[model samples]
Target chain A: MTFNRRNFLGVAIAGTAALSAPRVLGQAKPHVVIVGGGAGGATAARYIAKDSDGAIDVTLIEPTRKYYTCFFSNLYIGGFRDFASIGHTYGGLASDYGVNVVHDWVIGVDRDAMTVTTAAGHSFGYDRLIVAPGIDFVEGSVPGWSTAAQNKMPHSWKAGSQTQLLKAQIEAMPEGGTYCMVAPPNPFRCPPGPYERVSMVAHVLKASNPTAKILIVDPKEKFSKQALFEEGWNKHYAGMIERVGPDFGGANVSVNPDAMEVDIDGTVEKVDVCNVIPAQKAGHIAHAMGLTNDSGFCPIDPATMQSQVDENIHVLGDATIAGDMPKSGFSANSQAKVAAMAVRGALTDSRVFPAKYSNTCWSLIDTEDGIKVGASYQATDEKIAKVDGFISQTGEDAALRKATFEESLGWYAGITADMFG
Target chain B: MRERVFFALALALGGAGEGAADGHAEAIGDAERGAEIWVYCSGCHQIGPDAEIGIGPPLTGIFGRRAASVEGFPYSKSMSRMGSDGLTWTLTTLDAYIENPLVLVSGTRMSFEGLEDPTERADLLAFLREYSDKPSNIPEAAPTARPDYPKLSEETLALVGDEAYGEYLSSECTTCHQRDGSDQGIPSITLWPEKDFVVAMHAYKQKLRPHPVMQMMASRLSDEEIAALAAYFGSLSN
Candidate 1:
């Protein structure tokens, strides 16, 4: 019960025999325990398992039977794609790569012991633990948007259930009904995501209920893909979508769901349906385990994703305070691979390579065309720096639009394959 | 009907058991192991025993299939353009693309983290061969966050909510080039559109925007952590 440092390798090594485990696990192999089955966790599992070649033991702890990716959730809402398109399973990690998959939410972490305690009350010790469980909403950031209230005014930031609820509200609203969206200030997951959501929703509204309108209460004046998104909105939706930036009383200060109203600055406005994406921190487990500081996120050694306070534990994905980078699925997957490699190197006392990661995001402007942005990165002696990247340019080139849309699909296939495949 | 017949003839000549033997080197993927790998592919790809269109183009017979050749699927114009330009999907080409899709085809629509293991790629290719003769089946799983790990943690988080800290952060960033977006070597984070800055940073943190250094910087902030930093710097007059 008292997870000690010595127990780290022992615990990781013990869980190696669940499924498609390789026949030869070298004695010198390192041990890794990964928490979260999303992009980061799954990628780490695959690379570490494949690269280590049976030398490392990987145990992944995740609660969901299936994961619904937030990347293309906007597309689903836009009716460009369906929900099933972005959903994934962990069978590949279990069967192909020989990872031990546990279906349980992590409840706590015993950092000193290098052990992770799950909600099932089972504790798994690891020589190196990588945590990439994504973000958790910060309660009271918006006055009335509690976890309970979130059900009423779904944040849907986590995808799945919330996505359905938001969709349902949009569907049920009358032709002229008003839909209010509370956009988080900044540094949240998927920076361009909410705008994309609105774009998709507006597309749907225009067709199904022509007079329906969207009111975005943004704390900031601009957003990702601004010109391109505006171009699409103006050209397509016309007058259906209106955005209120900080300059226009969009910096909302409070929410009163009982009245179905959100107060921006000091003004309160009632709406028919509300979608409030509250401010967030690292997931509950990271916070509860003390991996996080007052800011409600974890701090780790950037090069290794190893917790600064606890080196044996690696905090990754949206949970860590990596500067400049956004919290996204692609970044999480890249980090997972790096962390897995680092864990393997550390366990076996092999040389750990310096890290490099890449990301690309495609925003669907319409059913036919899409916009994109991406960059590559490397670690220097002092910090992480971008090497190369690009964003889809403004204006519609039929070839570029079609190319972007197709590239989006390829990217979805490629990443999901990398993670789960 | 004509397409199906041609496909059948191609499968016969390609040799389903041994793979395409017309000097177009096929990958040496383990079909058995590849079958297991297919589970992950099913999440986003249309991969069953046979060819069936799913979230992505069916990978029923990808080994010898032309690049982006699924029928009825809206091919990215970049891809169709490539096809129009006479680009074909040979085994080697497929291998290169699988290693890194973006790099292999810059304008291609399939943005994926490439398969790192050589053997696994070969095996998956072999397994895909089995579907060449059967109906195509690919499962559609939604995509998740892309992977990116941070390269620094303590220093960056300490800079959160502090504009004065930009001097310190800029010290680390300036080594590559000037701080303004006008820098020549690396694109400048300074002077970027506020939304672009926030979203780009978010992408870096989530590992969707992959790089060693950016992942490192992005990994160190919380929501308030990022917002505070974004606000602090975004408010600065470039």
Candidate 2:
């Protein structure tokens, strides 16, 4: 649809709008640059570009040549699905949405000049900038956790090399070898994610090496779907999965990477394989550019997704402090659409409408069994809070579990379509 | 005669589509448009046909069924507790309930600010009537008997700090409570009969509410703030 002159001018007069029609159309469509093409930024680019058509020039700068999702990475570890199934290409974005996909890491953003500088030394000027650069692992939190040691002890938090490395470690372990996992603190990437990862890994251990044991050194006593997880663990895995919470001597205070051992409650235990998902914060570039606050996350208006720090910049997905919503692909996808709508509203110079976001997390316990927790969020004056929510009741209904599996796949497809296609 | 027949045929061609009689005219409802209307109800009830029930039981078949007829959906202890509460839901009863359920049946679980506009209420009632089972003839039950509860004495009111200041502080509670009293899982605070509302607020302040989220919220407010919150919620129509 062609931009109507009257509607464009009316929106511009609103002053809060992101793109003034004359200014947007007068020169070039105001460049809306997005950093990171994983879930959030890529989706934003696809949506804003498509909605604006030729009215907004959208550029997506992501370091990765190809994108691999963390959603079904657990299935790969369990040997249920291959790595190929979860991996995706940005071709759909470039070809279908006409998004300018640039394979480069953004180093910094000059808020004053509104230019984003990349590691490759290319500076793209933008009328509006969106950053959704996921999370960075805090290596030094566990005494021995570092990049060098990550090869032997993988975090597998970001899903590509780390996932493969951890899977290989699990395969190489002897029949009776120990598989230890360290779950991070709350407000991390995904709340129920670590538990799901552990559950999936345990499934592999039970199938290949029944005698092998899985240990979780957890920081929190209560976990998401604790009752359902315990029931499944007992019924399916049986003697395979063993958990150690804060009550037990399982609190991982430190680790010795070289020795391949973790120190818990002054006890040093050596393990055959270790998957440490460490504490995380907004990606480093946002920090370097002074976009993050003391909380290590950027604060933004839930309605507009525009940073409170700098109005010119909008942060979506895992990078921003979106309240009550966890960092998941689904959450990111939902937030991206809201942010894109806001950007569109701003460009046209109109009042941006309020947004409601929905997040659903599905955890696969067995080949066919899965559990889900979901909530729909609304933007309040101060924060985003749950307007409606649900947890899977305790049961082993095959129909529900199967439906959840199919819905999870559909969710991924729909979200991907909303972003790139 | 030929020209007149041709003219009649031309007029018929232009406007004849409206005159065709159909038996299933009412059965074929506008589900697409109905989906948009579903937004108004979604605050309390999940509109999904298969969606698991939330706070106010599922409305999958509220259309033509008797009011509060969903089995397994635990009716309010107030309604069930009232004993022999013969409230058969009809279009008129539903319209009245939408305007103000508390006014219609004082102790009912529904605490919604009834739809004020007559036409809108009728449309919503028609929408509900479209899905209900058999229409039944029954008179709306008399008002629920109010349980005896103690009111705040003058001394207690004195203890609650300044009254004027409390009224000013009640604005924040509206973040969750819209004027129409739509909510999911959360009780519509507006419809609370004053005494129960006051007691509940005091209980929350005293750390009686099971939830830490509510307890934390309650602990922060002062005695004056509590009174103001109570007054604001009491003023709201559920």
Candidate 3:
């Protein structure tokens, strides 16, 4: 039978009554359908399933069975970790946490009927839905660069093949060649990502191709950890890296992956490799569901991570306009906990706690040298406001830097375990 | 005990000092909420003017007291040792010990599992502060001087890790320090009492030990998270 509105309302009403009744054997459990099993969705699915202990059914839909986290993909390029180490399978979430892991791309969301349609012709009904489809690049944000040209000028922003391809291209660059990066504008995932990638590439080239030059054509006037990155570049890779900010016409940039040329305003320069990170918007599913606003991202209630557009729908991670929080995996994981608690409280008679968020982004500049920026946040009426923060200083001792790097490794292990289990 | 309580209230002298002006004097906690939480402690101890010790010593004024300062009290040997070792109860020490008594003093006989909720701890401390030595006339005086605790740990937040025991083990030194060791300078303290070791860790966790690495390692640990580490290392010699 078709999952039309009339049929949905009938089942939804019955499901609502079932939720209020004492849960026992043979009772219909409230189902929570989640789209995009990245940091946010996977963590939420795990939390709800594990915490509820079978009171709520969790279905996580994604296109990939082996999820590659974007957070540590840059480190994979830097050779700090193997590609497989960053790629995690949903076996644990499935076997251990009892999450129904569905490997399918979500095609559409019937908001009126409260159902999600998948590309495989399956429809999932939900008592609540969490949309955590990370981000999608705007069609024409970067002139002369598109997903079709992605192979030639790999935008390894998303992990997996693109990441491997970008790493390979950087390694294969001719000795003394140039590596050019067109950084994205504000409100992008992982604010320090592009710079960290540049560092990783330079770390590779500095060893293999010593005289290779790295150029950053950044649209923003300043970037995250600008001071720390600059100091590290000057000290470690002196005269090896150059960045052109908006003042130097960095904003007006175009790339030709075929010709291997980058035009900055009017001047054109031939480069060996170009990594184009274009402006991004909420995933197509969010837009398709009419959840995103004019900013191309979904605005959420700071207290619950619930989409302001729809009460039954929640948004997480890079797709959200999280106030005062950078779009990082840590942020997404933090937001996921809040959304999970809210979802459980609404569906079941669970205890609802006040919302708290915290995030830390660790960027490695060179071997054994890592810098971190982090802040703890509290949900206020306006938004998630920053309470306290700490950043690694420019002149930190070598021992401290090594310790910070070690701490980051611990965090990666902790978060992935938190997500998958 | 009176000295420590007075010291915390000392910061409140001059009624509204520069500390309060600069917003350093935030409320210690809500005593009303704290009173509700005191039920967990009331089984072993008592507070207020007519209070008396039951299973544990009377905690009428515990803040400034040494580990085993109460007169005629048959405190645990470890706590008595800690008292002699100069383990005074300031606000920081009180907060840490109340969060997890076993973590602060491994041999303490107080069988109450700690208050893991930091807000509840703060509120309980607020209620206990009522029974602490305070001048009732100074209405706006700082309740109890909490020397700059991290706001995140208090703002009704919690991070629940599954391998809490494993993470607790990470903060402990026995993973590196040996059951048998006395190399050049490292002593063969495998025979050392668990109470001494727990007291040393309390110093490190409280930033009293003042080493960078140890502080970082201990700061993130929750109450029950460290129980396994203490149980494993505390009895190593046995």
Please compute DockQ, using alpha carbons, for every candidate against the native two-chain complex: 0.02, 0.02, 0.03
Candidate that would win on DockQ: 3
Q: Candidate 2: deviation at residue A24, Å?
A: 12
Instruction: Give chain B TM-scores in order.
Output: 0.44, 0.40, 0.55
- The 10 consecutive residues of candidate 1 chain A with the worst lDDT sum are A17-26
**Compared with the true structure, what per-residue lDDT tens digits does model 1 show for residues B1-238?**
3444344334433454444333222334445566665555655576444657766788766654656667788776546655532345544555556655543344456656678676776666665655554312222111122121222234543444545333323323332333333322134345543443554565466554333345555575455455555554566564
Give a tens-digit lDDT track for model 2, residues A1-421. 1235455434333432343222233343567899988778887887787767678889999989878888888878888779987788788888888888999988777675566778887877676789998999776866778767888888998989889989999989997999988888776887888878878888888878889988888888788888888888887888888788888865556777778888888888889998888888898887877889988888988777788887777898888899999888778877887787777776754334447576778888887787878776778879878775667767745655664565455455555545556
Which prediction has more favorable TM-score, 2 or 3? 3
Best by TM-score: 3
Task: Write candidate 2's Cα lDDT for B1-238 as tens digits.
Answer: 3443343234323222222232221232222333345456655664323534677777645543444556677777434322222344444445545655543344577657556655455445434433333312222222222111122345544443333333333322322233344433233355665545554554444533222223444555656666655565566553
Which has the higher DockQ value, candidate number 1 or candidate number 3? 3
Q: Can you tell me which runs of candidate 1 are displaced by over 4 Å?
A: A1-29, A349-351, B1-79, B82-238
Tens-digit lDDT track for model 3 on A111-179?
655678889988777878999999999978889999899998888989999999988888899989999
- The C-alpha stretches of model 3 lying farther than 4 A from their native spots are A1-11, A14-27, B1-238
Fnat of each prediction, in sequence: 0.00, 0.00, 0.00
TM-score against native, each model: 0.63, 0.62, 0.67
